[model samples]
Target: MSCSSSGNEAFMPDDIKEKIHNHPCYSEGAHHHYARIHVAVAPACNIQCNYCNRKYDCSNESRPGVTSERLSPEEAAKKVLLVGGEVQRMSVLGIAGPGDALANPGKTFETFGLVRQFAPDLKLCLSTNGLELATYIDEMVEHNIDHITVTINSVDESGEIGSQIYPWIFYNNKRIYGKEAAQILLERQLEGMKKCVEKGILIKANSVLIPGINDKHLPEVSKKLKEIGVFLHNIMPILSEPEFGTRFALDGVPSATDQQQMEVQEACGMDMKLMQHCRQCRADAVGLIGEDRGAEFTKDTFAGLSFDELQIKYDLEARQAAQAKIEEFRFFLDQANERVRKEKEELSSDGHTILVAVTTAGEGMINQHFGSVREFLIYEAGDKGIRFIHHRKVEAEYCAGPDGTNPLQPILDRLKDIKLILTAKIGGCPQGDLAAAGIVADQSYAYQPIEASVLKATRKYFNLPEEMEVN
Candidate 1:
């Protein structure tokens, strides 16, 4: 099945379906209804990458390696119980670090153990650099960790490209540098991934697209991942803004553009399933893929909470019942979305496609107002159905009134290529600005499912018939 197609559950095996049906990161369809939380319990890394500079107390940043606070195993477990109770849709617990999960093995597994003991129903997973992965496969399996994400940027045996990304790695009580370091890291990454796959653990390979260095080399990496029975491949763009203080940013290496990322995803997607919904999430990220609610439940928030009180709040039976309702709603959504997919196929006979930008606060719906939107989820609607392309971040929320320069202009500049904007509400000023830029803004499908709304709106824009009912 094509990764771009909606509702991929039909191609999934029965066993795999049970594991990923509610896993937001693993299954794209599940993201709308399910949420995942990452605990920053592990804060020690073994390797140094040009793209990474782990930071604590950096709440403004949304990328990987940034967390507001690190937690102990006891504290992490308590947070999980509290969050699981509050965010009932929270189905997965991942220890994706402010550093490497495996690099801080003791803390990583201890947190996992505490969560398993307290909240056994929630699925457990972790993201790692894969340096110490080979040593922990059995332990991971023992802990019931069925899903793993390994960031594998280069598969070149020569280590020429890998050396450019990773300057040095601390291994076996020795610091290895340059090509030798790259070679060892690559060898260990590939070896660990193979071991995990052999043991029936689904592996998601994450490759950072460093433009000049590994842009053209990722297809080979995808080919290798596919050969080893890897489940999914996510090609993430390098975010090298100067404020983040990474080596790449300091050295003035340009960040990858949306076009560059799409090109690489298109190239690598041919080899395996591509994960396009990833937000390049922070280590301490909470709630849905696009939303973060970490601040709501700080360490101080649950300082003196006891295990008995948490267990009462956890309420496994109630959580399961709520999940059942979500599943039923998803069943109806999938059927409706499938109809829209067919409509898109028929409408694309003319071989034309349009880009659409949507304002969403998650839940896979167009629910955010134009003035409050922090980002716009970009999608391509037509022949291939409504496929997620990328997310365009807004510098600041658009506020009405003529206090300063037009806030709408900067937003209009970012969405120059978008044909239509699907939002919950829009004022006359921004709408006029969008019209001046040859873009159409509509609120007719406000609070609707994003994919179906995009498909229907695209058809409406071109005067095409909405041949099928989506809801």
Candidate 2:
């Protein structure tokens, strides 16, 4: 907890805040997952994504406006009640379907209101293409709904957006279909972001990583977003399914490679996240209450009651009357826990005990980040499966203050039975101390996710294994 001495800025709480604010790791804060629910409220969209087939789990393959089961606002509320507590973080309702969310303002705002009433503490979020953002800005702020994601493809509009590639705009309360329309929409998009920031709304920019079309536009996009004080940028690759991944897409719209994504992030001087577990839930997806979809963590999250199954066969209570479904879900959880346990044994478990490996930086500075400085976790493993803890970043004190005895002491005072300490580097005093405490110190960086340079000196740690050890 104590971050003092040396590169004092490391000790400064504010700097870490800045790092996390721009980084995806902070979005989840202390937890490994940011649970989000996407509600197919409008079941519609104003604009179309060339790579989007409007489907659930559609990397252009999933179908949008899945019609069999739609929930009214009240029904959606009941679904939240069932899922809210299961996650450490909660995002209520994303309108993801066939039309612009704001175009169906009544259904959209009413659904949001229902969620706010039921789960007031939940982090409310929504994603749209920005065609209708300006009109509903007041309503969004009124509902206290921020955490908004606007998907922008291109600022450059050439023609009527004719065919699969056309730029259209919604101006003066009309859908003007033309290249100029895209230009106008782009203007509105920028204006909309400014308005949200002015109103203290936290904005996240979602750029579908198109290969040849807008790939070059990322630097410019990053500049504009940063100027607007955007919190984070998720340059989501154009998801591709075997069937349509190539067909309707641009001449070269394959999913952007990890390298390309990293390149853009570095170029933009923005923290661009690869979004490892991004499920791209339907507009009405009910993900783990507070877990990240990017981590592939959908289990108990439900859009409707479990009893209702696909959708509500009856009212929520009526459907939930069958407690068997809940019991069944619990059973599945137990099974999954076991499977993960077995996997860890071969991969991470040294014996009957699961070896929770944590890598640290040498200067012993990784601990500073654990002191409530973030909202999300770097590692997305389920908490029930393993017991892992770290005081990774030892906060350094800025302003020429004394190191003043490490703040890590309090956090360290807590670990009941820590087993091993994995690090690429560590200094003498810290190494001697950890060794004295019974933690086996070792060097590793095979598949670590933390920045390597930082891991070497400051001691960054990552533990995702390359292959599961099979028994």
Candidate 3:
């Protein structure tokens, strides 16, 4: 199933060409130019690899399963958009997690769906432990995820070698250990790889060159993967550090030297296409290989920020004087409504125009946490005055874990073409997000009537003309 250079025209499929053309991890030719970003949306693992310690994020260390932050599906999608804009060369959005992506299927697929909806051209990639490979292959294909990487350390004739590499595996709702666990994992991984191959999914097999453990057996592993139709093989060197804290911490396992890695890669290259440029990136890695920009988007850098700080970041002065004058605000609302009514009449004479969104509790009061609000009261803002359009439903209370995945994407999608958003309060990240979409998020009035907030926003923020101008 391996496509040699000589037989490239004969065996390489169209899907394979398109997938590898822009994917840096699979194509040596594209690595130097095109960029990729991996969003750590999945944080739950189903298998335990002895060499992997997913606890810390070390910048100096380059390996899979290490990330500075874990974002929710919506959060991941937002970051993907932000990063794509920031890095115009980015062509792929991958879900290579701090944990197994398949184990956290809900978040993984949700992130994929949101990103695909927004970025249809962006290539989607996923890396997994292969425990739940078969279970999710159909779904992955359905989502158009063409690139998948499976870490297969050992496929020894006996399960002894694999047993040393992986301490245990969680399968069938239970934990299996020792040789039996190794056998099950290997069988499943191979079966899953074969399934992915049959589905026309480009498979990249990653084998850890764990010196004494699986280094010698890698040729056999590579041969099996090639025979099973793996498109590429990546042999990664294990980082054996006691401070990293894993089962292999004090095992005295010597790290594979540069000479050892090259030699092993050469031997495996004969059987299959060897990926020599594997940087062993972290789960939340961004930008080009070896050029990590994750620090710019970390939770500490962007999360837990107040709107005041955000206003200062954008250099927007506090509207303290305007806010204090309740009478002026109320007057603006009245004039805004009258102007809106006239505008709507003109718009309805022809067609319709703009939409506005507001976060509020029932009975028309501006209340509810920006992160917790599950519904938005949408309105059609025109010269006819702001009229209630409908209620837009979203995921309720998305504040989960340190990296909270809000239903912001879906909410934004629902309130499409919205000119402004009136809310009691909003975080700095979301405020910036709204601003990017040309939607103003005004948190100037809290516990105020919804109509007053909407009217004030229309006249002052949205630049809607007053009734006097209409006259």
Candidate 4:
């Protein structure tokens, strides 16, 4: 998940390793099978791109910075819950825009915070112009936003080439144009890229290849991005259309040909990882990459439905799915335990068995915060390796009320057999409370696959001599 401009991938934490493969646009395996949805909650842009036309929305046309309807933070969260229930494979939720996501900071972050509460398992993603990205980098990380895509059209520090692509940028309550704006924008983008890498957040750098303008300069852009440890570089073809009313269209700049795109991609591939399957999706894109469902879930679809009605429907569907998943885990645990009975002694290191509880929302990944988890997946580990038991449901929620009372006591009581708790993060009070109950709390693991974390945890902490041999 972590890569550099040198074309070498360095070591990262386990959570980051699992998050990269879950994103459709970032991973080849995820792109084919996993589904993602983007909510158009941000409608204001801070900078102007030569190829972008914000007024056009054909529904048939698929490109960035275009959407038919803009939803408020609450409405967007409702739509995400609705779509997530229908598309069980939905693993990522993004806020791309009819405008820049960070430009509309209030609305964008409100929607992100809402989705975090609603669907903790869904990987939170955002795409920005990098003008305001550096300012919001720490806030984004606090919100558990792991996947970030920053569109840096040009990295020319001199602003000679960048001035042509971005004629003007609105920064600091002033409209700066020509070289001044370009210099400011380019400097901010590179600074933001460095801050992102320093914080260990996965970044995908996107550059729109404007033929005859910045086409030849993309290789340099890619090289600079790779030096910052950007995980991937996406070279997109610029779309020049008269209807969109852009300088590129008026100037008659031709769009990059298919062969031209491939050539640029191949060139960048030599320096770093090149992403080739970008669809240039709209801000309101839904469903798969090539197949967008934005039109189907337009504002008209929810004409008579109220927010309360949608909430009720979502709760019913979520409850059913939760119960079903719990039953499935119970059945699998029984079977796995039965199969491992014969090999139990061989798998055990010192004949010590312990239960480990992981905070997770989905079947595969540890994608939730400790305070947000309502259920913990329980696994028994020993010489026989690790086996799924049943999930432990907590009566008291972690952040439901004031922190004066011990809300985690009930959860700890329910997980009496558990010796270790693995979560994304835990507060100081809860950590102390858990230790008092003779349970070890580990907050290093987050956004990782359940099976992978379990295997590693057993080997490292449980002192298991041999690999886990489970069916």
Please list the C-alpha lDDT of all candidates, in the order they appear. 0.87, 0.47, 0.71, 0.74
lDDT of 4 by residue, 252-326 (tens): 987676557656765766676766547788888888655587787776665456656665545645645654565
Winner by TM-score between candidate 4 and candidate 3 = 4
For all the candidates, what are their Cα RMSDs to the real structure? Answer: 2.3, 16.8, 22.7, 19.1
Our tally of clashes for model 1 stands at: 0
How close is every model to the real structure, measured as TM-score?
A: 0.95, 0.55, 0.62, 0.65
**Compared with the true structure, what per-residue lDDT tens digits does model 3 show for residues 293-320?**
8888766543554433433332212222
lDDT of 1: 0.87
How are the candidates ranked when ordered by lDDT, highest leading?
1, 4, 3, 2
Q: List the residue pairs that clash in candidate 4.
A: 5-226, 347-383, 348-383
Model 4, residue 327: C-alpha shift (Å): 18
Model 1: what TM-score?
0.95
Q: What's the CA error at residue 226 for candidate 4, in Å?
A: 1.0
Q: How displaced is residue 270 in candidate 2, in Å?
A: 5.6
Better of 1 and 4 by lDDT: 1
Model 2: number of clashes?
70
lDDT, candidate 1, 251-368, per-residue tens: 9998898778878887886777788788899999999888899999999878789988998898988899999999888877776566454332443657798889999887677899
| Residue-level error in angstroms, candidate 1, position 124 | 0.6
